[model samples]
Target: DQQVKQNSPSLSVQEGRISILNCDYTNSMFDYFLWYKKYPAEGPTFLISISSIKDKNEDGRFTVFLNKSAKHLSLHIVPSQPGDSAVYFCAARGYTGKLIFGQGTTLQVKP
Candidate 1:
């Protein structure tokens, strides 16, 4: 039920600034961490991910960090743009690729 949690419900940031989103999980069995971005009328899309063996992973302007010991993870977006405004969801995948999702955090980037 509460295996995954997003402490923040929403966040606002100026365009071209950085946006940080946080997530925590209670299940240590999760080995794969992923961040998904969703627009209001569309399904969520995969953004970034990090494996449990690695503490951090980066792709272009996005980065995902995982702390296995603390059961915490975070997504970072650098130079955030208006197009980046959306709901972000943190998800965990086990070895089988089954995902458990946290309550989404809505991000708003002002132009």
Candidate 2:
């Protein structure tokens, strides 16, 4: 069963604007949240992460928020740039320490 899901398959945002990516999960056992950014053929790289104990975490232009009660999480990018365009994957780790990922959302940052 798919535990994580990204309802929107894609998102478009203007350069220099804020871009928000949303993800939903059904598993309450998940203990960690992470977002990965992938460019074309390249493998997805760690972008940002938030622990289940925290409601928010920020790293530079990126921020991740976890809402345990709602079983949802989001990634925010401020002042998005063209180079930031890529496929974003939302992942969660459960008791097994194995990651479950959602259907990626492709982000298009237009300059």
Candidate 3:
């Protein structure tokens, strides 16, 4: 079963603007959330993460928010840049290091 879901297959944003990526999960066992960006033919690179105990976490231009009640989460990138263009995957980790990932959302940042 797909524990995680990314409803939007793609997202577009202009440079220097906010780019929001969304994710939803049906499993409540997840205690941590993470976001990863993958370039074409390349491995996914870790971006940012948030804990289930917290509502939000921010690092530099990236922010991650978790809503336990809704079983939802989101990643926000402020001042999006062309270099930020890639496929982003939302992931959740259970007690173990095992992670469940949503269908990736391709983000295109216009220059």
Candidate 4:
């Protein structure tokens, strides 16, 4: 059961605030983790990634932290803006470039 879980279906935050998204996984074999941000119709764009060997990875306003022992990961965005409002998906790379994704979380940024 390689199921990645994003418990919250959506989140809302005021602009200039911090936005945090959570994800959990049952499979321990997943070694590569990624976070993707998706707009309305376009496909998800890679935002940040962390390998199982690392505990955290960051890129600009985005940061991802992984706790291998708990099989949990989180994405954090600071000073959230309207542009950051979109669907975020947590994925883990499997054998064949097949990524197991969570249901996704929609973040709404208020002006």
lDDT of 4: 0.92
Once superposed on the true structure, which residue ranges of model 1 sit more than 4 Å away at CA? none
Tell me, by lDDT, which candidate is best.
3
User: How does residue 98 of candidate 1 score in lDDT?
Assistant: 77
lDDT tens per residue, model 2, 57-82: 99999999988999999999998999
lDDT of each: 0.94, 0.95, 0.96, 0.92
Per-residue alpha-carbon lDDT of model 3 for 1-111, expressed as tens digits?
Answer: 899999999999999999999999998889899999999999999999999999999999999999899999999999899999999999999987789999999999999
- List clash counts for every candidate, in order: 0, 0, 0, 0
Name the regions of candidate 3 deviating beyond 4 angstroms. Answer: none
The residue pairs that clash in candidate 4, if any, are none
Report lDDT (Cα) of residue 60, candidate 2.
Answer: 94
Between 3 and 4, whose TM-score is larger?
Answer: 3
Order by lDDT, highest first: 3, 2, 1, 4
Tell me model 1's lDDT, rounded to 2 decimals.
0.94
What would you estimate as the lDDT of candidate 2?
Answer: 0.95
